[model samples]
Target: MKKFRYIVCLLSLATLSSCDSILDKGPLDAFTNDNFWTGEGNVSGYANTFYEQFLGYGNAGGSGDFYFNSLSDDQVGRDFDQYPNNKGVPSSSTTWRNGWIEVRRANIMIEKVSQMTTLDDAARNHWLGVARLMRAWQYYKLVRMYGNVQWVEKSLDITDEGVLYGARDDRDMVMDRVLDDLNFATQNVKDVASKTTWNRSMANAMKAEVCLYEGTFRKYRKSEDSQKAPDGAGATKFLTACKEACAAVMAKGYSLNTSYQGNYNSIDLSKNPEMILYKAYKEGLLMHSLIAYICSSTQISGMSKNAFESYLFTDGKPLALTALNKTDKAPMVDGHLSLKDILAVRDKRLSQTIDGVLLYNGRGYTRYNVGMESTASSGYGICKYDNPAIPEGFRNNTTKNYTHAPLFWLSVVYLNYAEACAELGAITNDDLNKSINLLKDRAGLPRITTAIGFSDPANNHGVSDLIWEIRRERRCELMFDNNVRYWDLVRWHQLDKLDNSKNPDILRGANVANDMSGCKADKVGEYIDGSKASIRAYDKKYYLYPIPSGQIALNPQLAPNNPGWE
Candidate 1:
């Protein structure tokens, strides 16, 4: 379709009387396909739809029930009915879980933009890449959540029952299409932009994450009836893709922020180079519940002691090996072993990520002894995303503080590259400097070397001690972020570690509360015993979520839910 320049000439007295010809001019109120898509601004405006639809913000509203950082072993929420606990889930409803609705919107934009003859090749390709990037992101999230789903590429007729109620595509086939979309996006998207915008950096980051997830997810959880295109037990191919994608972004010169907490709790994102992509929030225009969540009395989702125990000793050795190894920390203000001692001897990230004290009305209230029982039951004060400046203020008053939430950062790219290479058995010391060492430096821990790894061995990962440490770095650095630790457990087939039946000690932590005066050492113990917390246990069936019962009813093609989900 060749676009012609549309020039509107206002009607005058002479032309007004000639109403027959005057009505032929373009209408001033609305745009038809002929008039729209004739300028860059319109096309760009259409592409902007993906941002608000697919992305989320700091303390944002619609991210219901998915504080991924909170629902796993590392962080525990008081609401025991959330995911992995296997309660409070929908029995059936395809409402939007598979993301077909979002895909339909993106495909319309892609198709409309492609048909615009007014757009130059560069403009068209760039816009297309943006659309594809979003499409790939949505599909990846869907597949991860629902296994395989109906793959739709274009807007469909509502009355067309066959297309609307069709059988689902295989997960591997859909993911291959997802990768193809990502590949196109990486090659064509813009390289420089605001942290909130999509670009090649985001594309590569998605590729690194998606490919590595697919690779590990396939290796750890595949069944006899799974997608067979990317066949075999090894995750080498996708891991290689993950490694190269991460390296490509690293080449763009993003580095770790010196202050571990610098990337978060900011009013703006202009200065954080480490955040390759983030959700920008402007106070009054687009603020969220981050402040509310941190300060609310209902803030039950607190960090777990497992997370605190995961941090390495200051000397880069595991606390498991240090003097702090299960040694009762200094008796609490209440005369029980508590977190106070660990804060002093552990890596610098401990205090930065968790809170030990709160300043209230110019007086300091300790997290352990103070009356914060309503906020956290296990005595772990989750202060990671708290407004760093407002310690005394809880449930922050609607103030002018802008909280920019991070989505993707360079450290993830580094970790992704390092782990993928490690999985391939091709990582080296130079690779460590390029990837893991950067995080070690940020955490003020010693760097890894062949000699260092052998001298001080890691407790997990048969691959190598270095690989285990790399995994540990990821666990600590990305802790409380939710998906990283939980997903890593899935891909590494380590969810069994969460099982109290097999690992009876999985749920133990310091159970401290009010009035420290009479508190004895015997008063402190595990928050939930093995008999009561049955939901924390994991089995092979938990590897993949069940295809919703509602979805199967809508189309029986989805029946015979994933392994144990039935």
Candidate 2:
């Protein structure tokens, strides 16, 4: 029998009756809120409830985190003109509701854990750290979306309406509190044996991520309001914190997996050295459709032409500056390079991430190729999460596909460390070797040194040559995983890259003229539902999402919706 874990416990808890008897008079045998706080097991079980919410590979049949960047410059979806462009002011948002819900849950856990007198100091501190970590995670997300969110440390009742409907706190104030929580988590969260559970390393990783975001956001954002930081706490302070946190994780003995492709397309990552935390999916108990989505003949979205071209050549030089691109013109076919040729000279990760050849019905590695299947919108199919080893039956069934999802990994920490160093303006070649060069070595590219003085002409972000290269490496390494690209753009204050009018490359897809037979010679871009891919005009207001209209109405303090929306 498979060992029942957090996910199983969560599923079992969901099926329980919500009757008054069960609510008021908690069952003696089963764990309830009233009885659950008595032991470590129950406290751990409660913490498990947050795992699915924060870490799990999304719903079985959904796109999961793979398509999160569809709204950003990295990838273009079938609905190209969706969010950040056509986003509307809603009355309420699940993002707002669910965030507060999770925050309350974390606060409740902290309160309950504190009340437990039986637990030893170590155990109590561990559980408290877990709760604080969770709270910080939610707040970090909330702050990212809404600039100045209300900071609630404790659970509030209806009687505490003043606290509930209080004015939005300063971003710096909330982030400082978030930093405090992360510090507590990093110091107190035990180093657990289970890779799936939260540990001290994971806490440090989370802190690094949070600090980098805030630090860069403050440094890059032009808005005076957005740049505000608490006394003695600004970009330098947070970035230093980010650097130290990353260094803490680096000392924990994590390394990159042998194959870059194996990181994403794995069934078992429990023992993978790169993984700090991963969501385990059993064959029968819990599975996801991400692998099936990649393997199936379904018309998935593709990376943007800009994203595809961002990968550095094998020589660690951008295409414009690479001699290989100038010398070898054979790859060029009908004004665009063939998919095979494109993947050949660029970073090895390109081939691992995207299909090297056009795959359609009765073609390529797909097993269940129904005639109704269509090619990806961009003609550049995403193969990052594809696993060819799974049997035919399993690939076709959404729920049966059992690929593990990496929630946190060492590569991200490496990127975090490198970027933090670069942003701090004190990066050394030794720092590059310790962080970015390791990733370069894994990607089979020439090692980058601090003396890389040449700048890519594509440096539209106005960053230094080193910073630009670091950002590119980050983009390539973390593509199609989570919303890294989107958030990176946001923090760097470069969302204008999404403007199709300004950056036409973002809307362009694969060069399908040569390989895809029926594709028009003139129309080289991805077509969706008989229309070419496009994005609406970009606005500065898109930097921060609008606080829901209803939320503003209820509080009035949240008036003046995010910049352009007003």
Candidate 3:
């Protein structure tokens, strides 16, 4: 796969600037339009650029998708809360702009793949599948952000005026096209032996994810903006698609990695059966600072109280109703449950995610105090991506850590299967056995059956007991990975959970003792609070991001910017 690294550089010379430009030109020095598509290797090399563009682990000084939960209810930053405030509208958006650039690149590949006369039928279809898959991924991102974006299937020339300045397509219509591309990819893409590259299994994984999102988004989000499916059969159609996609991936013989912690903290996932697709990082060639972000003394962010309490006890019950609550019996540290005691009664994954020993400024601290020097915003230290075996010198340095990042895995597929079944009101004990129970087994907890009679007092999302449990499993399993929590809230139409005025738990952290140094005695034994001003009250318009004002100005057909941004 190291060849992909160099191929991306070579392909960049042929990449177009945007979708609205004339795409007839080719690289002058390296290759021309006539010669680049002459071989299968060049086609594969052209597709290699999408890997770096779409599935990057992290750059030198940034934690890529690992900490994206900061924008959701799972975590909060130290300087301020991580909620989006009412900033009116933006003049332009790089996400909106860069998305078109990649879309154009993918469209060019799709068009050029048909011109590869030397390749066999199998080879040509494989390249076309790869190109369509990349295009679908970019459009999915666009739809997730700005609801109704123009669906451009081909690389448009400057003479194409209607598509360049046209009204945005309906959400369901564009998603159906995305679904078509995904179906094509799943059928035509060969199953590559390498885990890092795109394949039939990866396409299935992505299809399951995209369908589940669209299904739930339609079921929960209500509006009159023509986002609904035309035939009024939106939720069931996409949820069924999600279910079938999951089943296809499950049949591929992928299993959970025995060590739950090893999934994220591993240096090499090349042979891990759990990983369907991952971003490979070499020690010196491609490394990231995610481990440094986790292990450093810098005040990044930490898990929120809302997220911490979502993990169920070993008996598979919420902490409020569980008999296994150890707050009274466990040893007290600074008037709070000791980290060890907290780990004793709760799910094992919690211990794996957060460090048990408190550290301040890279030194051990016995007291679990909030607002300390090295403690995160919520006082809970995140260690999910930390490899403890790495030397302190390298772990603290930027771009030095090389832990592989999981992009798509079997656990997520399992969760998606369970959720799709539950959402379609077709889940059963058999579904539980095959999906959520496997995760429960890995966490060393009791298996859940459909006969759950107890209702969690903490469940305020208005879902049934079984569906809530399945959602909880997803939250715990995918804690800080790749903005899953935030998008989950969005697709469920539950962004109101981030409002601290109604849900104060989002602003609270670990309880502190009066005697702990630097602790505010008056606020001791109470929720460690964040500033209220940091969170914006939820608005109905927040469901879809506002389209760029500059774009709407350029093309008046994109008027009436999202719901309330007008």
Candidate 4:
């Protein structure tokens, strides 16, 4: 018989509902220590719940934390007045508080699982390895948005008097906590079936991500005193950690997807060798956010044109005036170049990362979702995770009906690898060959020599080339995963570029219409919205999100706004 244990007092807004009160909840009478450690299947089932929690952590109903929308570079809603401006109140901040709460649950689980001593050494280690990894996973998210944050080693008992009050820790300390957990897991965890399982490879891949962010952030902005610039040597050391972690995964046999499209094709995802680890969304297990493009009129109010048009034509045709381009006006050439042609002679990844082709009746053709027409736009939604054969209208909205949401994947591993290589100035032909070859092979294109640097110094790409190449690939490879243009700008110290005081043209837009074939042509690119209405630049202080106002009021130490808010 299957036994169960209910943990009361779950933490985090996006975490699993454990128990209403940690102390109030009683352990299952069916099984205590005597029967808990009996089988592999039982232990594995518990691990599975951790995976499901990643989706519930985010706001699917568009109400909770709304972190997804806050990351949008497309448009801001008037309904939530402050967040549009990036000003959030702590008391009202679900994402802010939930993140901390979520990490605590992970810590608690790790503690509980470790204490189940009935298992042998190997089995015990396996569970411990995953717990360590989950600890790292939870911290990685916290560090990313909040910068320096609080770290807890054990689960807090909500019923305890001390549970209600906690203080934030220094950023470096939090990072150290992440590293501690990752390093321990890497050493103890055994290999598993694939990235899909709660396995060792996924944990290591996560370490690579955290290391890169810390190293880069510390190197670039390292000020002995808060206002000073980062030291040079720090950058080198950080990149070293990033490179080693990426190479470790590469040695473990991870590679990029053969086709740029293969990385995302719903049918191809489970088998994607390039993905280190990703969350599984069974038929009834997840929520679909891909509906944003479901239909222009009839489809759910999804698919923002602002987000869609950011994708440039693969052949260097700039969709955004701020982006790089070859032509002056829209449709400068015939039929707004086909997806294959736009990607011509450029990096093979352009097609692999975005919705570059259309599939119909088991055959792929040139049909594309034109932004202006709800019918045509709905004709082909992003194939990233959708089952192609499932008729067009079945599960297109956010009613929790069309279940599927991926938390992570191996593509991130490859991207992280690419970033490290480019930073080290050691982007060897072998490196490019490995990365691009995987993509080209999938696109059915002939692989070329990796000698051509997308940021070749000979091409006068300069240091900016490295930044552009990595960031561009990131945008193309990970578009609509609830991440895109805006944050990249913030990370690269390019937030100033968004400032209207200096670069008024960055936010410029144009009025255009579609051709008969369902593609919009930029007749004349113009900047209709100016500094007053449309933003050209961002305030440096806004780089780190505001420490929700309500949070500060509750705990003086906890609520100090990120640098600029006051």
Candidate 5:
């Protein structure tokens, strides 16, 4: 439950008023009626409503969409919760992030579609599958945000006190139900040959992600649970499912798009191979201002220097190897080496993902206007998702501009496949070509030989060389999308990077004294002393957001709000 109380409360009041006085009503909300799901177009249109609320397209970098990465070491944002000072600000209201409303809406669609005789069983099931997938994704987010949220499979009436004010379901129970939704979606969703819309492939992509998250999360956060649930999920069971799910996706034939930058910054990705699913933006129709956030003088958000340097060198070596720093000339602009120099000689993604100008596929791209109010909060500016082609006239309004945003792509599937295999130590040489090598091929870096991959320079994740690099690839690959970095950190139990007390590594940006100048201290956060910069506080309870007090006030079953949140 997040800030959705007022909407639900108002609807309940209206229903009660209508029940009390038969003639007091104006026109009631028409969408609630059974006849709405009558036809293919109408049912499809109803399904499309959830698309508007989908977690794709990065949500335009606002406080409302509130990038969860702001809490992780990967990003810095305008929100106080994102600051590095020793403070804990768990959201006071979990109702705002609630998925119950959406779940109810989805359930309505599923219920109405079930009764419709106009459409054939297959057709009806397709719409139902869509609803199921949406519901599952929504519930997954809810469960992730607030553990053991109220699970509603069927739409409940306002008067149904038992289910309306129900006890929160066990997270394991909720996730199992979520998996059931996913299974139904996979069985019923028609296999379409396009990436623009959801289909079996899209559902499979979501399944892979869900399974991966659940597997890794359960593995790392076992401490949160006193006893393992009846469900057989553990490190092995879920990881196997995760690996198989990715294989299912690969069997669908999604390959990496040749240009990684194009995957993020392109105006059109309708035909891109790596693009498994994306939100299209036609000017004056459905567009967004994501680019405006990126091109800003001081981008509202910043990627950490840790995240920035995580990109391996152009020679397929990590920055941890100082030998690469010694012999390999870090590319320099002018005589002096700026942070951009690290980018110039590092992995091609460096040029594609961060600071200054990059020339990719003969297109000249520029970002981080140095003269403006400091480029990035962490010194290293995040230039991802910037579309240079957008006209200046429309840049101010995100709606009027047409910049297609990536939601799901095969590159993630690639990372997923590699990570799962690496996690299980089942990675064969052939698996490399199918997974990590595809990404390496795209980046034009050397493919991992057993000798080079297993060599020294262990990453801070404390995993094996291959697994660490696999994770590093994932971190750099999906940094700005979907708060994947935060999820990854949480799952890997590597929040140590975010622990400012033990080490000041992530708290500080690129350079303590150099990078954060002229920018507002609030935006840049507290760059205390000459060494530590971003000093964010983290408590174990911060892992799960606390359920809102108002919610608990309505239903006491949601009591003992997540460990530290109270």
Candidate 6:
């Protein structure tokens, strides 16, 4: 409870009559109505609090629940129930509740920073730009989730009777407000070189992301006879804007990480080239708790049953029915695959995401060291953030921790560019070539096509084919970046199109007898477990998570519960 108190403090919602003096200097200090607007650093620090909130929810809990496996082809956990369950989610509320709180804080910073005479025009403008940008980011998440929501431009006092009873805003009104904030941010924000932290680039990236989503969502939302198709003229304009925004950062010299493992496996800031706007975790933040909580007690993290069955074999079954194939000679199961043979050609990212090797002892993984359970039993303990240098005997329950998680990375920008080009019908060979080559070449994989079996830049594909390729790339490249998986399905409205089976059928029947041996009285058994078979089945209603029942009773205007929940 004390840990979550930091969130309240950052939002200025703490019971401020007491404990104010002790936490005043800390980042979690409550913003009293009286002394809230003081110095430039205080304003900036308050703005930083909003960023901290985003890091807390978007990447930490949201990513684990939705991004990692819920929307992926991995196993889905059985104990889960949410909206878009079996294709119908309610329209009453949204998944992101605190987004508005962050927006309000950013607006407060924007308003107060303008009056800080102690800071020069240049510094003040820069800080204001960041505040506006952060506010836009908050709105972006809102608009993406629930089309039209109430838009609030100014920061409201929670204690204000008017604020506590405010109603939801129209969707288009929110977009206009987001655009207005972004326009200000884009013009006043200094170039990437001038900024030190991820503040400015993220602001710029938010503009691109919002424009792309609005353009695409608008195109898709309208009726077929309503003068807008999926590839309409409005979509074209928005795609152009996305291209320009992403290009600006690329011009500023942001590039992909050369090695996939290094990008996620290690937590050092110097080596991380892909993260544009991420929250940096220090020792006390315990941002690591979110990661460690999902893994095994011996390792780290505990995966929910809904998240456990998201992965599948090419045949679309869970791991119980499918076996991990070592050779590429068998019949291609899921044809039109992203790569020629996915099992044999494991993506470079797989190593970074899973603990395929044992970590109990300080030694490399061997064939017989069956200490850790696979994705089925342990719910896919994502090892991407684990630091191998931590002493092997040190249990994750105590010493192990993750320092940071990127809220928005450069890879998404590339994806935005790819999607926009596909919508525009201007997806040239050069575009696909550059996009896929940049991603694949960096990861040491062969970019294969129908004409060229692998890495032949001469073989260029059509826009449709490249779109599928890009989606696959994004799935593999940006796994667990945020709550991207669930939202991706929502944006495309493809949640219903998904086949919700539980297990991987491919690895189930393969030569696994050698891989199933047990060690010393079943202490180190690699044998297949019965639980893996149970996770292979799918439930349609697991799409949008339930809006907490308590929230529904709080406001009658907020609409009813999602489809699957009673």
Which model scores highest in TM-score? 3
Q: Which scores greater on TM-score, model 3 or model 5? A: 3
Q: Which pairs clash inside model 2? A: none
**TM per candidate:** 0.82, 0.89, 0.90, 0.72, 0.83, 0.69
What digit string (tens of lDDT, one per residue) describes model 4 on residues 197-308?
A: 7666766676787777766666555242123376456556656766776777777776565555444434335766666665444444544444333322432111223334
Candidate 1 C-alpha lDDT tens digits along 18-100: 22232334564456444565777766666665665433333444341224345456765555523452542356544344366
Clashes of each: 3, 0, 0, 32, 12, 50
Q: Write the per-residue lDDT of candidate 3 for residues 1-566, one digit (tens) a residue.
A: 33334334433533633211222343345565556777786777677778766444596766588774477777755656544536778898878877887887888888888887898999899889988988998899999888888999887654466887789998778999999999999999998767978789999999999999989888877554324533437888989999999999999899989988898988889888899998888778888888777655666577777888888888778888888764522334653335787687889999998867433222333322321235566667787887757766667777888888898999999999999999998888999899889999989789988867799998889999888888899999998888898889988878888777788777666554422454431132454554435555777777778998887877789998888788
* Model 3 misplaced regions, further than 4 Å: 1-28, 224-232, 326-337, 358-373, 514-525
Against the true structure, whose lDDT is highest? 3
> C-alpha displacement of 507 in model 6, angstroms?
13
| Residue-level lDDT for 359 in candidate 1 | 21
Candidate numbers sorted by lDDT from highest down: 3, 2, 5, 1, 6, 4
Q: Against the true structure, what is every candidate's RMSD? A: 8.6, 6.3, 5.8, 7.5, 6.0, 8.5
Query: What's the lDDT of the predicted structure labeled candidate 3?
Result: 0.76
Error of 6 at 65 (Å): 7.8
Cα-lDDT of candidate 1: 0.63
lDDT of each model, Cα atoms only?
A: 0.63, 0.75, 0.76, 0.50, 0.64, 0.50
Q: Candidate 6 — worst ten consecutive residues by lDDT sum?
A: 515-524
Q: Local error of candidate 2 at 449, Å?
A: 1.2
Cα deviation of 105 in candidate 2 (Å)?
0.5
Q: What tens digits encode model 2's per-residue C-alpha lDDT throughout 370-424?
A: 3224356555668787676777677667777787888889999999999999999
Comparing 2 and 3 by TM-score, which wins?
3
